[model samples]
Structures are given as structure tokens and as C-alpha cells.
Target chain A: MSDRLPGFSTLAVHAGAQPDPTTGARATPIYQTTSFVFNDADHAASLFGLQAFGNIYTRIGNPTNAVLEERVAALEGGTAALAVASGHAAQVVVLQQLLQPGDEFIAARKLYGGSINQFTHAFKSFGWNVVWADPDDIASFERAVTPRTKAIFIESIANPAGSITDIEAISSVARKAGVPLIVDNTLASPYLIRPIDHGADIVVHSLTKFLGGHGNSLGGIIVDAGTFDWSTGGKYPMLSEPRPEYHGIRLQETFGNFAFAIACRVLGLRDLGPALSPFNAFMILTGIETLPLRMQKHCDNARAVAEFLAGHPAVASVSYAGLPSDKYNQLARKYAPKGAGAVFTFSLKGGYDAGVNLVSKLQLFSHLANVGDTRSLVIHPASTTHSQLDDAAKVKSGAGPDVVRLSIGIEDKEDLIADLEQALGA
Target chain B: MNHDAYPDNYIRGILNSVKSIAMVGASPVNVRPSYFAFKYLAQRGYDMIPINPGHVGKELLGKPFVASLRDIGRPVDMIDIFRNSSHIMPVVEEALTLDPLPKVIWMQLGARDDAAAEKAEAAGIKVVMNRCPKIEYGRLSSEISWMGVNSRTLSSKRAPAPTQGMRLSLNRMSVGGGDTAASDRAAKNKSEQS
Candidate 1:
């Protein structure tokens, strides 16, 4: 074997996977079963007591999902990872491990509409308060810190707008506050930017997006960077304190660097129970094998489309960091040098009516609520995703009435541009 | 120097070379991580000597407990420290006083002391920090995969058949007897009859 480490593309294909042990089949076979049989009573006891690592039930873990988890963890340079049902499920599992009742977590103001709703509403019920801070202003995050602050959350690339976040700057704030920096890397994916390298303690992803490439599956993952000292200050009891459910084993003390991921799996997934289907894990695994290739094409096509929209007379503004004139261009260059990702938003000169009209006139781009698919997708976020937010909140999230989000696909750039031109003209 | 990562070969070499391990801070309590590790290594055919000054006469899984490294009259191949990070320096100093110094010093998971590690390495001793021997043994032997944990090592070679009182070695090929087609067929036939 060579001393050299495997590259990103190679890891994307081969990490966390081998030929079927029994059948010798090449590709990973979906272990569709729900529970694994124990070797004996001793083996069963060992697994339940956390003395041994093995699958006991599918709700907690599965073989197919384990492969997906390891692949993402390797890609993100994380010590370990956990696969969950959806992007929202990933968020719940992650925060449940850190926050107690009445604890506060700082989150960027510019986030996905669904996330904003979840934080402001569902999380409030659980007494996990969210203090909003502007990603553009580093001081806003530092100012939001309180004695109760347990974590700082931000996205590597803001959804809808595709604006680049200053991860290192926010990470400094988290460090001073003795909190973990959690970055949602859904928009960029590991192919574009690895948040762990930028001081993120934990990275979350909606594998339903570009990682899956195809829009056929819904899955999410949490990657543990293994950087934080969870046992310090006794701030994170779920990790530092003895877990009563697992024979009073201290997760951080036993699992060490990968304890956060384990806590999420054993405590959060075990109780809350949003488990990823084995079939979805299989689909996402196949999708990830081609991530590097697909992501580059998506970026190239997106740049062409953004450029065309910027030149169009009917378009008032474009919010893609790939454009030289975009506000986040410099940060984009520093963080995601590969490309500025493929999902971005543009405003129509005629405002909301024009945005909705263009969506109807478009021939190729599918009108949907989702982003990051193999085919181009279009959505007027104000009337759809961000409709819950009032006028000022909508504009702040880069989802104004005139704003139309586009998730560029790997289709030929010229064909995409031509389709947009006809829709704008019509 | 990066204690967080060790080459697979380096870990494999240490595990294979060491025959007996004196585990500092070994507990009589069955729930403790130290007890779990001691029992596991003992089961894997290693001479596991438990050391605890507080429980000098107590035993874990039939292995007699010693007060400290000095109490072990025989030459120990390795010293597995299960103490806290701050308490490691004294333990390392004690291990160095042994007539024939241990070949390796292994710290339990979450237990790391850079200065102690440097001191041991200066004395020509191999040191592994913030890692669990039981997990490493399971991973290297491809035993962890049976429970769906990613061992992060891939191989195509067939696993050896099980024998009475089976003991898996680190050098064995990858195994997943739990998910094999033969097991699946047996399960299916049993379900059909029921």
C-alpha cells in the first residue's frame, strides 16, 4: 500500500465501503434488515452496555447507513458521523446533545426559511432559545453570547442567496465563549468546502441536496470534527455526564473525539427516532460516488446562468458569490475556491408578479420548494418558503418578493441560458 | 507527533508485540470502562494485570490486582494508563522505575498528556494516547463491523470459520458473520417454519 492518503474523489467512492463480506458483490449491498442477531448472550450484553460497537437495531444504526456515515465523515475530515432521516432531523439530534432547557444557541439571521421557522417556533417550545446574529457582522455574534450560550450555528453558504459566511471569524467568537461552532454545509457540500478545516466543531448536511445529486432521496448527516473538549466546564452534560440509559457510561470519556456523534446516535436517535431508511442510504451512497464530478458541472452551469441573468434587462440583481461583483466573492474565494456552489437567487425588475410569471414561463427549470437536484429548479421563495416571515424578515433572509431562487443543474450552460432568455422575454 | 492519528501499522505492531499489559486504575466495578477493557484483553488471550492502589486485593474477571507497577514482580510488556490527563505524569514516572521498562505506554480514551508522552518516548517507549485498546482490537480484527460500526479498513479476504471459544486476532481477514448470506438464509428458513 502507498504511504500517501487517498484524495477526495477516491474517498468519495471507496471510503466506508468494501465488497460484500459474504457474497463478494462489488457495490455496497443495502442491509435491509431492521436488527442484527447477537453472537451469544455475552455479545448481546456487550453491545447494549456500549462495551462493543455493533448494530442492535435499525432505529439507532444500520450497515448501509454506517457506510454512508463513514463516507461523509471521511469526506469532511471528521472523526465520525451519524446519518438521520432528514436535514431537520439532523438539526434536532445535534442540538439535543448540547442544549438543556433554557440554554441559548446563537444562529445566523440568514438561514433557510424552514430552519428559521423551526428555531423560532418548535425549538422555543423545548426552551432551547435561539439568539440571531448577522453573519456579515462578526460583532453581532460576540454580542449575542451569554452565560447560557452553548453553541454557535452558521451555514458555510447561506441558502437561497448563496452568500458566503465568514466561518473563521464566527469560530473565534465560539472559541472565546467556550462553545462549539456548528456549520451547515448543505449548500457547499464537502466537494466545494470542508467546514471542519475552517474551525467548525460539528458539520451538518441535508444529503438530499447536492451530495445525493438526484432528488430521489431525503437524508441528513452530522459529522463530528472531534475538536471540542466536551468534558470541560461541564457545559455539555449529555456527553460529559454519565448517560443513565447506557449503564451510566460517560460518552465523552469513553468514545473520546467521536463522542458527540455517539451521543447523537444513542441518545437523540434512539429516543426521538427519525431514522434514515436503508434504501435512502443506498441511493445517497451511489449519488455521493459521483459528487466531485457532478458538483463541478453544477457550478460551471450556475456561473453561466448567473452571468446571463446579470446581463438581462429584466433582472434587477443577482446574489451568487461566483460573480465577481457579488459582495461575498472574496470570502467565497478564500473558503470555496473550487466554485461558489450552484444554488443562488436573482431579483426580477418587475418585482413579485414578474418573479411568479417567469416561474410559469420557464420551460426547463422545475418549479419546486427544494434545491440541489440533478435538474435545474426554480422557486419564488417569498410566496413559498419564506411566506411565514413578515416583509422585513423576508428581505433580510434574501427572499424578497422579487427574489427567485435557482438551483443550477449539470445540463449544458448554453441550453440553460437559452431557456432563461425565452422566459424573461415572454 | 500527532497523537490524534496513528498509522494502522504502528497500532497493529504495538498490539501484536505486547503479550502482557498492566492496566493502571483498573476497577472492580463491572460498569467502569477500565473493567470492560480489562475483561476484553483477558478474553483475547493477553495477560491482563489490574493495578489499583485502592483495591489492591480485589480482582477483575479473575485477574489479581496489584497496588502499582512496582508490585508486579514479572516484566510487563505494556502499561495501559486509565487515569486522568493531569495524573499521567506520576503514573509514567512509576512505570519508568520497573526493572525492565514496559515497551509501550497506552493511555485510555480521553486520557492524554503530551509531556508524559514525550518523557516516555525519550525513554524509548512507544506511546498511544486518547485511544481505547478494546476498540482498536475489535477494529483491527474486523470484529466491530458485525455491529455496523465503520472500522475504516477495507479487505476482501474471507474470515476464518468460528471454533469453540473463538478468539479473533488482529491479523485475521475482515469478518461480518452477522450479515452473511448464509445467516440470512438460515434466518429466512427459520421464519418460514414459524
Candidate 2:
């Protein structure tokens, strides 16, 4: 293929797939088997030795999943990609490769509450530390970086609160410290932003959300831009040092550009065993096919909803980057020109009780913990996701008690507004 | 098909004994299949030495190019030929002349020569013609099944659980495995209490 690349719509449909070679099936078949038969013992030896590449078991790799991996890698302009069980699994595996025991990584404070909980509590058990930095303040990222910092993580569009991150500015800080910049592009998806174009070394996604567009599949992906030199200063041993388990093969010296992706597969996913089942892979792949159409509609409806909320007397504040009045509007214009994504929050004038009441009254919007579904969704973080966090911590995480988060869907704008209007009870 | 399918044990033996490979006609150009094959094998931890006379002094994927298989300085265990049908004989002839000849001669896709194969086999070197090491690795490793191709082997037993940290679950209800608020609270309380 020449430099004139295929458009997003085309890549979403065809990138890592071809008609089924065996049966001539147009759709990718789900290979549900756990292990594959070897041609002979030598073929098996080469596979086990890393002297060759192939799926040994579903836990390590699968046929249906590989297609999804390639499709996302192609869309993100990454050299290679790895597909895992969920969006959170993507973060865990990516860090598993980067952070050694007792090491640290900097993350933006404005992240999904689930991620904040994951990084703050779950990761600590693995001996990995999270140093929080304000995404709005680029300098805060630089200051958070210490000698132990292996990576810097941020969401392209901060969850709950629709905010765009200054990826280029923060990437520079990561560059100065000789670490990779990883951007979680789940909310914006590749339709709105390709973080690699903005200097991110790796782009991650919760494919279950917008990419799947249906919220029916639980999947995650790690896309390696193949930019970072893992061998530099020999900080990343999992990639640099000879792995004794794999017969003393050093991943970086061998893999080069796709080494990080390879490391995540053989080292992280292999050991952690958070493998995506082939059935889920097939569903997520089907969902990705309509990502472009669904994302555009999701943004259009969200822009309308954010505007409606901004005007409502019952609403205290609408934190949607699509609105010019919102704090992240300028950054949204620069980073996500298509739109600032569909998931955003609006605080109620009645505070905690109003936020809870508004969600309960909404007829169309499902009150659920998930996002990026075709149907709109609403949640009160103060009562559910962020309930455990103290008030001071909750505010810092953009999930204050007065906030009501909405994951606007690809429905008609007028119908969505009417539902919200009735729910506001004005 | 000009290439013979060797026994599984023989192929396995060759791959296991060999440590380094000298890829003849290796290209630095990204679009070429040779470049990818070279990259994939190198990443799999093979000491892949790319031999390209055209880009004599240049580096492909960080490793400097060598003028010929003989110029790799160390003992090359395998010679992976990426040249066409007409050039295979000459490439094999060059491989035979090296002080420590390669133990195997692998012809890339469409690069086969019966005479060269006879020569290499006569020299007690294993010969795999019109086949790619990259493809062979994947096929043998069972990794190629991800493409919906049939993996001839079948087993009924499930893969054993990982011995390390908590097992990750991807079910719809609990997406990050055990990332429920209750677990978070427990972990948080423990941290504060400590």
C-alpha cells in the first residue's frame, strides 16, 4: 500500500481481516479452541522457544483476537497491538511490562474513577506506585516524575468530566525523563484523536466502550507506536534482560519496534492470564465495524444534550468540552475536532439529592455503571463508584456528590433532550 | 512443489540447535515481505544478521547491514534466502564456501532450487525450500490459528490457571476482574489503618 492510507471507516471494517481462508466466510469466525495441534514436535519447540510465532493456547493468543489486535494497531498507526479481557486489563498489562516491583509511574488525576481506584489500590499490591498529576497543569506531570518513573499515563478525554488532555506538552516531560507516554484513548476513540500523531508512544483503549459501540463485549487493547527505545539505559529488564523462562531471550534486542507489544503478550498476559476469549473477540470485532458511524452520532447527540443541560435552571454546571463555555473547550477544539466525546457530567442545583433524583427520573437513560453503549446511560458516582472516597478526594477526581454523569448515546437528539428535560423536573 | 517436507523431529532439531541466522537479500524497505520476516525472526530472539550489498553500510531495524553471509563475523547457524528462483543456486554456492557453513538453508517464499537443496543436503545441512522460517515458527507454535486457520492439534483439557496474582475476569458485570467498590474500600481501609 502507498502513502495514501485508507480512511477510518474503511480501516474499522477491514484492517486486520480478510474473508475466512478455510471456509470463505466473510465474517471472522470465532476459533473457540484452547490449544492448537502441532505439525510435529519441532514446530512446537520453535513456538515454545520464541524462535517462531504462533498461538500455543488461547491464554497466550487466539485467532479471533489477533484480528482485533491488528485492526486497532492499523487504526492507531501503531506497529503492533495486544488485545486483553477488559479496559482495566489493558492498563494492568501495560504497566506490568513497564514497572518493576517498587517502581513508580505518573498518571493524570482526571481519570475514570475506576482507574483511580485501580491505580491507587489494586496496583499497590503489585508493588507499583502511582503518582498523581493534574492533567490541566503540564508542569505538574514533570514535577511528579522521579527517577523511578517508567511511564506517564493519561486519558485523551478525561472520563465523567469531558476534558481534553494536553498530550504534546506532557509527552515532552516524558521525553525529558526518557519514558514512554501512554494515552488512554477509549473515550475519544481513534475517530477523534490518534495520540501517536501527538507524540504518545502507546495508545490504549477500552474497546468495550465506544469501539464496540454496543457495550456488549468486554475488551481492551494496547497499541505500541513502536517509538520508545526500551534498551535505553537498560531500565526495562522485562524487555532488555534475557528472560530465563523463554530460554534467555531478550525481547527488545530481538523485537525492535514491536518489542513492547511482544513483551506485554509473552510476559504480562502470559503470566497474568487475563486473556480475551475468542467469542468476546468476535463480538468486539463486529462492534468495531460500526465505530465510525456510532461515534459521530454519539458526539452529535452529546453536543445537543450538553447544550440543553447548560441552559437548564436545575443544572449547576455541565462539564462537556463540546460546549464553548466549558473549561476544556479550547483543548477539545485542538485535540478532538470531531467532538469531545459523549461521556460527560452535569452537577445539579439540588446537590447530592438532586443528582440521585435526576438519574432515577430519567426514563430513557439506563442507570448503570458502564459507558459507550448505544442507549444513553446515567450514574451518580457519589452514591456508587466514588462512594468510598472521602469528599475531598471525590472532588479532586471530578466525581463530587453533586455530579451526575451521562454517557450520551447514538439516539435522536430531540428525544434525548426531552428525556433529560423531564428528568430535570423543572 | 520443489520443496520437500522434512520430518517434524528434524525441523525441531534444526531450530533448537541453531542460535543465529544470516538472512540473504534482507531488505530495509518496510513494505517488502523480507523486511517483516527479518524483523519478526529477530524479535523472536534469533541473532538475525541481515545481508544486503545494496545498502552495505546502512542499518535496518537498528542492526547494521553486512555485505554477505560470510561477513557476519560469527558462526551463522542458518542461511535464510530471500532471493528469487534463479539466484538460489549462487546463494547456496556462497553458503557452501564459508569456513563454518550454515547448518540449515531456508528458502523464503518462491525461492527454491532443487540443485541447491541437493547440494546443501549432500553437505549434511538441513534444507527447507520455498518455506519461510517466520511462517514455520507461527505454524509450529500454533500462533497462526488466530487467523481462523485450522490448528491440526486438538486437546480437551483447559489451560491451567496462572500461579501468580489474582486471575483477571472479563465478564460484563465485573470488567476489571475484582474491581468492585467493596474490594476498593477494603484495600483503602487497610492502607489507612497501616
True contacts kept of each: 0.21, 0.08
TM-score of each: 0.92, 0.73
lDDT of each: 0.85, 0.78
- For chain B alone, what TM-score does every candidate structure achieve against the true structure? 0.84, 0.76
Weakest lDDT window of 10 consecutive positions for candidate 2 chain A: A1-10
Candidate 1, superposed: residue stretches over 4 Å from native: B1-5, B113-119, B138-194
lDDT score of residue B83 within candidate 1: 89
**Tens-place lDDT digits, model 2, residues A1-426:** 012334678778876665564666668889999998776785676567665456689888887898888778767767678999999999999999999889999999988888989999999999999999999899899899899999999999988787899999998999899999999999999989999888898889998899887978899999878667676678999988888877667776455456688889889898999999889889988988998899999999999999999999998889999999888889999999998899999898899988878877889999999899999999998888777678888998789989989999988999999999998874
Model 1: per-residue lDDT, tens digit, B1-194?
Answer: 55645766677778888999999999887678898888778877889999998987777777888998999999999999998777999999998888899999998876678889999999999999767898788777756544334455555555554332346656632222112122123223332333
